[model samples]
Target: DLFVLPSYYENFGIAVAEAMSVGTPVVISDQVHIWNEIERSRSGWICSCTVESLTETLKEALHNRAEQLDRGKNAQIHAKENYSWNAIAQQMIKAYGEIQRANSKSANP
Candidate 1:
């Protein structure tokens, strides 16, 4: 399933990640928080949430079967590496450590 989310205000865009987990390429709006990551990973196409942009991107994707398949494969790899439970837990631990250090600094000051 190719997932398309022309969102105006999406926080996590879990559906996008879920689709990617199953090797689906996406076309998502720039407003989605994970858009930058998706773009960097080459897991999907990103565009501003506009009729013209979405249409143009979809058209471009339709003409490139190899590119679409490549994106789908990349999406699955990225999802496994970045959105898996282990990955999320590790990130959470790292974030908590940063928060603790910041709090300690403020307390000491």
Candidate 2:
């Protein structure tokens, strides 16, 4: 199955991530902030926000069974590795640690 969203504006597009988490291939607009990740992971198709683009993307995505399965698996893996709660927590912890290290260096120097 394919999840399609042609939003004109989106902050993070949590729904797209949710679809990816469930191993569903997606067709999302470039307006989504996380489109870069989707593109990098080969998890889905990205298109500009227009009827023509969305329709063309949908046509291409809907007919490719082999690619669909591959993309679905990639989507699941990408979501788990990058968007899961544990992943978010780990990122936050790493960021905080970096901040702490920077502060310590400044204080000592």
Candidate 3:
């Protein structure tokens, strides 16, 4: 299981996505920027940041093992399709190429 807290003072939430990317299910606090994404992707559960809420959410996630497995699969798929380094590199290259071409045209005129 993976836990993510996007609060400004998170002790360690950055590893959540990495774990999820490798097929681990995630439980995220609403304070996290990726909470909505995780929920929408069905990759994990989201809850309020309080201890009570976190405990309840974690309990629910663990009790629903089948559902959690499904979510983990979804998370893995999403991570592969959206967060892969190769895809990100391609996107960055495309953006840079576009900017370079635009700059060249502006410079010519």
Overall lDDT per candidate, in order of appearance:
0.93, 0.94, 0.78
lDDT winner: 2
lDDT tens digits, residue span 51-109, model 2: 99998999899888999999999999999999999999999999999999999999999
- For model 3, give the 10-residue run with minimal summed lDDT: 3-12
**What TM-score would each prediction reach against the true structure?**
0.86, 0.97, 0.77
Between candidates 1 and 2, the TM-score winner? 2
lDDT of 1 by residue, 1-109 (tens): 4699999999999999999999999999999999999999999899898999999989887789899999999999999999999999999999999999999999999
C-alpha lDDT (0 to 100) for residue 56 of candidate 1: 96
Q: Give lDDT: candidate 1, residue 30.
A: 97
User: In candidate 2, which residue pairs get closer than 3 Å at backbone N, Cα or C atoms, i.e. clash?
Assistant: none
**TM-score rank order:** 2, 1, 3
lDDT score for residue 46 of model 1? 92
